[model samples]
Target chain A: MIRGKVVGRYWATKRIEHIPSGAFLEVESAGGARMVAFDVLGCGEGEDVLIVTGSTAASWLGGGKIPIDALIIGSLDETGKSKSK
Target chain B: MIRGKVVGRYWATKRIEHIPSGAFLEVESAGGARMVAFDVLGCGEGEDVLIVTGSTAASWLGGGKIPIDALIIGSLDETGKSKSK
Candidate 1:
């Protein structure tokens, strides 16, 4: 997982149905590249987060297939500690 | 999943044990970024492949937590079609 800050949010009108509502988040990679992530955790803008990419993304939600490729698995606290941990 | 070309192979002697031997691959993303992947499929250098990144990287090995964060799940054919498809 890579550490990044949530830069923005995403609202897709026509998207795959498997994704939960208000699940997309925009995060900037530590190296400055930005990508969309599925927000399994409720992360606000400017919040530091850890993103899980690849097929494990969908599997994190349990079994069955999902159309998601990235997921915000954890949010970071102010001290750079993981809030979920 | 993303499309990439296998640029090289990796052999880590002092790495995590969950990953299989001869599993590390150097893949160049379509956008030109290079990253390492776990080779579930035996992919040769110069082969086109589909990579699954993130936590699902470890999950693709079935159950049990693994240390991998990327996986080469499929090898593409010369026709630009996926060989496993």
Candidate 2:
């Protein structure tokens, strides 16, 4: 899983139902990977987050196929930014 | 799937019971889905990660959507950082 933050959101009103949900986001990691994220979990702009990708994405969606490549699994607090751990 | 990192995390005392979970992370990928992912696998600062987006994210997860799409499936060691891949 990649670690990054939700930079912004992108939305397409006329998208397929099983295609993908929520707004699109930009996540940049310290590892040098900048990825786009799907479904910002109420994630505000400039919030760091985690992301998932690949076949693991199509494992078992509600009897339907989302066709999307990523999903927002959670939200992180300010604990990690401390740099004191 | 988009590539990124767990820039930060979130911990909600009370959520929608099924909207989203874990700490939200930011990830950058070659595919260009700056996405927030779910289920980050013990990722840390400056770690590059892979992300899955859309309905592709909700396959099983005990059988639910957790809403706010995006999931982090795996972790990358230090090999990808060489910037030579």
Candidate 3:
């Protein structure tokens, strides 16, 4: 998992059929690296988010061979606090 | 896939049980971001390599849920040329 901030939304007309219906968010990690993450949590711009990468992310959509590599798993309650904790 | 150069090897005394046996190489992408990648291709230091991330990398080890995120798939024949092309 990585900590990041949602910068904006990404719009793409063409996508793979296997990709689930969701918003693609542009995120900047704590290290300043930016990437697009698939979001189902309805995160808005400027929100703090928890991101899962790699196979773990691809598996979050219920076990299928999806091309998604990054996923926004949760939105942080506060700047650095999680809702669960 | 991402292009990176193997900079060195990483050593860890302990790791997850599900992790496969292979070399953990330190790689720097073309964008200058450095990361540790699992390698089974016997890539050498300073060699340019092709990398695959996400579930695709985990699937390369025969389809199991592994913690590996980045993997070195192939070592490039030249600086900017692939052996396949």
Candidate 4:
């Protein structure tokens, strides 16, 4: 697992059938590594999130095989503090 | 698949049971991103290699579940030119 901030969203009209239903969000780790992650958690921009990579990520959509390599698993609590700023 | 150069090897004595038998190598992409990848193909340091990540990587081991995230799938030909230097 890795911690990152949701930076943006990605839209892909043409996708493989193996891809599950979800939103693709851009995540940037504190170390500046950026990646696009499949999100089922409805994360918004600037929200702190936890990401899972590799097979475990694709496993979220049941035991079926998928090409997805990254996934946003959780949105961190903001403690009532705004993250958009 | 991603292209990278094998930079070094890793030795982990204590590991989880789910881990398969293979060498762990350090790979650095041309973009300067580095990662530890499990290698079944004997790859030497400085060799240009192709890497597979996500479920595809773990699928190499008979399709069983494993926590491995990255793998060295192929070594690129050097045309008899030295890459070790």
Worst 10 residues of 1 chain B by lDDT: B10-19
Better of 1 and 4 by lDDT: 4
lDDT by residue for model 3 (A1-85), tens: 4456799898888766788888899998756889999987688899866565876666656557688888765565432211111
- lDDT (Cα) of model 1: 0.64
Q: How many pairs collide in each candidate, listed in order?
A: 4, 78, 1, 0
In lDDT terms, which candidate is top? 3
TM-score of each: 0.50, 0.47, 0.51, 0.51
Off by over 4 Å in 4: A1-52, A57-85, B79-85
Candidate 4 residue B6 C-alpha distance from true site, Å:
0.8
* Model 1 per-residue lDDT tens digits across residues B1-85: 9888877554433222344454556676677666656676788878889887666667666644354567787887678553333
| Cand. 1: chain B TM-score | 0.80
DockQ of each candidate relative to the true complex: 0.08, 0.15, 0.08, 0.07
Q: Is the docking of candidate 1 incorrect, acceptable, medium or high quality?
A: incorrect
- Could you give candidate 2's per-residue lDDT for residues B9-61 as a string of tens digits? 44533222464435555554554444445664667656777666655565534
Q: Chain B alone, TM-score of each model?
A: 0.80, 0.63, 0.86, 0.85
The parts of candidate 2 lying over 4 Å away from their true place are A13-17, A59-63, A81-85, B1-85
**Candidate order by decreasing lDDT:** 3, 4, 1, 2
Worst window of 10 by summed lDDT in candidate 2 chain A: A76-85
Q: Candidate 4 chain B: minimum summed lDDT over ten consecutive residues — where?
A: B10-19
Shift in Å, residue B25, candidate 2:
12
